[model samples]
Target: MSGTFQDRIPVLLVEIMRKFPEERSESEVLLVHNMLSSVSMFRRYSGTLQLLLARVVRYQRLERRRVVIKKGHWGHSFYFVFSGLLAVTKDNDGSSAFVDKEPILIKKGMSFGDVALIKTLRRNATVVCMEETELMVVDKEDFFANKMDVELKREFDYRFSFFRSLQLVSSWSYSLIEQMADHSKAEQFRYGHVVVKDTNDMGNIIFIGKGQCDVLRVVDLTSCSAYQRLLKQYADSVSRGTCLPTHGFKSELTNQPGSVIKHKVLLNNPPRPPRGLLADLPTSACFLIDTLHQSSTFGLNQYLMPSKQRDCRRFTLVSQSMEIMRVEKTRFDKLVDNTTMKKLEALQKTYPSDDELCTVFLEHSRWKDYKHSVVQDLFPHRVAPIRSPKTQKQQGHCGPSQVLQQTRHVVNRLKQTKQRVEPKDNKIKK
Candidate 1:
């Protein structure tokens, strides 16, 4: 793939090279090398990306500290830093820091405003030039300019993502990974702040792309008695990999590789309860994130907050950020064996595949249905999930007696809850 992309890359590079202003040629080559050298993550799409790079126009060269991409402005092209680091920054919220002329630095991977371009929404954060930077800008015209082969281009896009995830962890297959990309969020919280109490919605998977957090129990903030007791009960039992109670909200520690953990699902939030009252003990908001570098700690929580009007804005932005990353999701996709594929299909779990899921169906007949296992697997060490009766037969090779036992566990819990509530009803009548 590298040899072919390199062979064909020069041809495409010729056009852009000839047209580029002589001053930025060295910078352009640097960007080309960077794109070419991404062998592991982007081996398959190297050819297409090489072409993508060639068609780009090397526009104006801005000074080191120039404001390149402004927040909320409509941007259409992709830009690369040929040399030097370009800081992704936004204004501090009308605070003293802003008056003092200090713009906040966003983390390196958190590219500014690309999601707006892809989602066709407004830029959410301003991207400023931190140092003297050389940039290559490619617009929609450049994107659509080369009409070499659309079919090949599309296939490359999907495979590129597959390869990216495959490279991350070779354990996953495309079948396990298909339709695997789901809406996600990057959130931040102060060290002591609670992200979510120990509760399990049994929906959505959590990944700590950056930073870390501690897993705590649901305790009453107002009452010391209950809080101490709850904390004491599972004081040491809830290690990172340990699963939360089947009935409680699910979460895990992040220090270890495969631990059950939960994060606030910012991409989608359940409509707030309308009773105009808080739940028991403030739900003991769990301070799920335990670590943060000065670089990543700030801005994440604020970014995930729902005020963005365009709710999908964050997902699109992060997706584009992931796009510039240019990794193929191949690793996770290939991990999809009968077990993983069945689980993904049974749960109807959708990850950030874009159009990649379509091909997954063609690969396996069982891919037609969603899998609950895929969702559970996604959450690191999240334990065996509670499956619905309808999804039971699809659970695959299960012992009937065990299935019946698990079925009773799920059903009897509901019955016991009803029985618990009956006494409360009688007491009210008396």
Candidate 2:
């Protein structure tokens, strides 16, 4: 096993080399040049993937202790800090100064206090990173593009995977990963094409599907695999710094344009959300199953507020024949009356904001402009990760009081709606 793992690395390397035809070095890919030509908004914002927004909002750079977002203040937008550092702080102690008393740090690309956007919720914590931080503010409008493209899909997918991995997936068995490449479509890159980059929303979920992406510093070739291995190994060992390398396991995360990143798939499923409501749900939302039909307080609580991501959608789907149903929200209402919708209100509260994750929304936006006719054909069945029922154990997620509260609300609402719709029988008297 150990020998095969080591041998696999080198074999992957040669594949990228043979695959990259035009250039000997990574520098020649003309990433920035090509990007500038490829996108109109690339020049406007230093960061890539800036153009797809249906709109844009600007905010001044924070110098020293600027109040980008106040703890307890509603988070109306997300800031993309282009330059400098911004410290994130919270008013945890109920002190006068939310900043001076207890401040948290927020670095570039890392968002803060986003949970406060919904239902006029107060910012849970205060955040700060550094000074002179230039930020691209994503207001409610720009953040919630009705359409999603490959870019937004990839971003939401990465974030969804990131948070999900933090929970049940870490302990997942290697055998359980269902050879991801089996379903994925393969993409071979020329020396000039980039496979991945920092903040890229290309929707590329690569795995060591087949060949290794022999990576170098654009300055050297023998350094091939050296940079990839070094960064990856460093990420594995480091206590803090960049995001964990696992989210986009097969792709590189960097900002330099033209820096060649290559990918094949271990398991690839192009995203296909139904052309209706559930498909437009914000990225932060997830499903919790009360599959057993048990009225147990614990079971009910667990499904009440799914505060974290989970592997399965509450129900343990065994048979493959139970087809996926993609109904429009209206169609859903028509199929199941108000009795069936009692649980949804509880689920919807967790994701208080209507704002879809910026990445997910962005991907939808880009998908509209795609020229490939086959692209629209993708995303029929999504084999989301399923936790093994035998080995899996319920963690008892929600509080008893919360469960009671939600249960009462659902039961009451269902009763009221049923009563209001009841028809009177006047014809019998006539």
Candidate 3:
């Protein structure tokens, strides 16, 4: 090491540097720099990266075909491919099959085993050397103690609660939920932001952690035309001093006359049983349908089904200042367990029939738009508009005194919930 080369060099060509007998001793430092530069996560924490490389990382040599990692076992180390080739494979059915499914080749300068380490979950795939290989590995203790791992653990813990709130994944165990959180990332959108444009283009499943979204499905002209017809009839009834039938518009309109105008309005709309009134739902009534709220999930159904037979997202998700968690489709497929899949299937089975779902949508929309407006008119003075806490706070009204009161109220509520579910430990799982 005549003149120390502080700059980083390629991992594969480290041997070429060794040829310079003078700089051979500095090869270790060069390799560490290569690892840090190659990984984006490491780049974020240069100080910690340097310290870990110097203190914890160790070089290991493996013969061709030696298993570096095994699926289903707890992940203990994060390995960086320092040199030579490796093959990555996953078990399809968790069986002792000698053959690998969907094998992937990992070459020099690449990293694997970090996903499992990030979540402190079981390995989802196995990695084996394709030839005599050199790897730089940081064991679990050192890996998790790093600042990057701590940050990731904190994020995953926060995200796990959102997964628990969702119906599709609510029943999953903490371990599985943690894995899902590992693959997900938080995203924020302003009001009316189109989260998904073309059905085919959307690649990740979105879970609403906070706020609302309008799920608009493309409807045929016939459906739109029918809804327009209904709106026209309802408008006519309102003008003629006749009430629009409630019970999701299933009842026939009554004949009512206004003061001596001698105007005759024909009511051709027939009365039908509630189940037969699928046309009443907002999905059938308008070109766009607004639905979904906190804890709702979209895009999974498309991913789970085969491409040739997959049902494209019939609905477009437009958010309103929504905070959400999104997991990529490829990651979802790799991580979702059988239990979660079964739960999703069960949820699909529980979906209301087309007609019934539509009726429910109609009932909900009617309550929000028509019913509430009529009620407000009847008791204009009595209906003191309710103010949200957020709105109040935004007006510079949430002072220290008000915050104290809110804190007490929230503490009381938490006391009750805490009786049913104990608080999770702050220590990161490994």
Candidate 4:
């Protein structure tokens, strides 16, 4: 068995070399044609396949336990694993520390580092050879010029068409969109899976690529009976030294945001109301106020902000078995020029202010004693179905959420109006 195994290695290498064209030297082919045929992405461009195999691809061998790629460095080539095993590891947070996760095993006949063929982005993970390995590699310049650019163009026209339709990104140039498409990664989530939780600091900007998700906010509940119990205790109570009912129970419920002022005022002067208090006081309420669907985006504000500054998530994003595309903030920042940034700033102004959101939350909490609809109008009904322009033509009508369905259209009109007024103003000044 040992002798056969040793003989197999030389035979395989010889076979790979013999497959080259008669005119070209044996060293020139560098890879087996059958291996290239296995990659689905490369199959469509058959006319240029042989040329790509000859000019770009090369064969390389890695020794056991050798690091082939390191995290945080720019990737300039795509690697196809022909034989042996590899281990993949990445940092937990965008930090330099990589001890957070165990290495994932990748076996033979698979490929990795495909993103390197397009954009010059930092490697999110490190790849190391687990044993003596054979690989077929394609470097960036030829890969993009000959093959990947064509695939990326079709991808932008289909699966990622949402990037072009986006009102906020409409002002972005074609080159900028191409750069973003290169750096963005497609990811999937199962039902009931939490994509992003409150207080999480993942710096990637997420755009729903294909499905739906629920935006949730976890809130603590204080039952109506608990509130009334507190009120009754306060009415009957007094200082420990005084002859008032000092033995009544003290409610230890957690405080809500911005409650310090309310507490101070209540201590200074108490309002005595008649006995029959409202029975329907909130036991609990929705803290998260929005339901984002396909094409919806988040983390852009944080992405635009400086990296050194601390930022926290306000809501939790739980997927309903969806697919999403996310782009690293650092990659976007590197690719986007000053002109693109200015257009993005103009687009940002069109969004409803963050101050407006805070006001809505406060109003909703205050109206908890009234009908639910009184505050419900402040937010959209649910996740709105987002279809691309091509799909919209095939589909008959929009889904249930009227507000969300119209929100993007309204924002686009606002942008057009703003531009019109600005040009007129410049003419008037002249």
Q: How big is the positional error of residue 338 in model 3, measured in Å on the Cα after superposition?
A: 9.3
Q: How many clashes show up per model?
A: 54, 42, 0, 0
Per-residue accuracy of model 1 over 36-147 as CA lDDT, tens digit each: 4442222323454544444454434555556776666776765544343455445522222223464554322232343354446666665666554545565645455544
Candidate 4 stretches greater than 4 Å from native: 1-65, 69-112, 116-160, 171-173, 188-192, 210-212, 220-286, 302-314, 320-322, 343-430
Off by over 4 Å in 1: 1-45, 57-60, 92-114, 147-430
Model-by-model lDDT, in order? 0.35, 0.31, 0.52, 0.50
lDDT of 1 at 105: 47
lDDT (10s digit) by residue, model 4, range 176-216:
77667665645677775667655266667788876787554
TM-score for each model: 0.29, 0.27, 0.37, 0.39
Model 4 is weakest, by summed lDDT over 10 consecutive residues, at 245-254
Sorted on lDDT, best first, the list reads 3, 4, 1, 2
Flag the better candidate by lDDT, 1 or 2.
1
Q: Which wins on lDDT, candidate 1 or candidate 4?
A: 4
Tens-place lDDT digits, model 3, residues 1-430: 1112332234454443333223334555565565556543343233444444434566576877778888888988887665577777775332322355545677666667877776578988777776777676777775555555765556667788778766776666887777787666566667755676555676677787888665543332223333445566666876797856554332111111100011111111323323433443222221133345777667754345566765443445656668788777777777676777877753331111223323333434444456656866798888566889987555433222222222232223323433332234211010
Write model 2 residue lDDT over 134-236, tens digit each, in one string. 5545565445552323444454344334323422123434332222211222223332222332212222222221222221111121122432343455455
Which candidate number has the best TM-score?
Answer: 4
Worst 10 residues of 1 by lDDT: 252-261
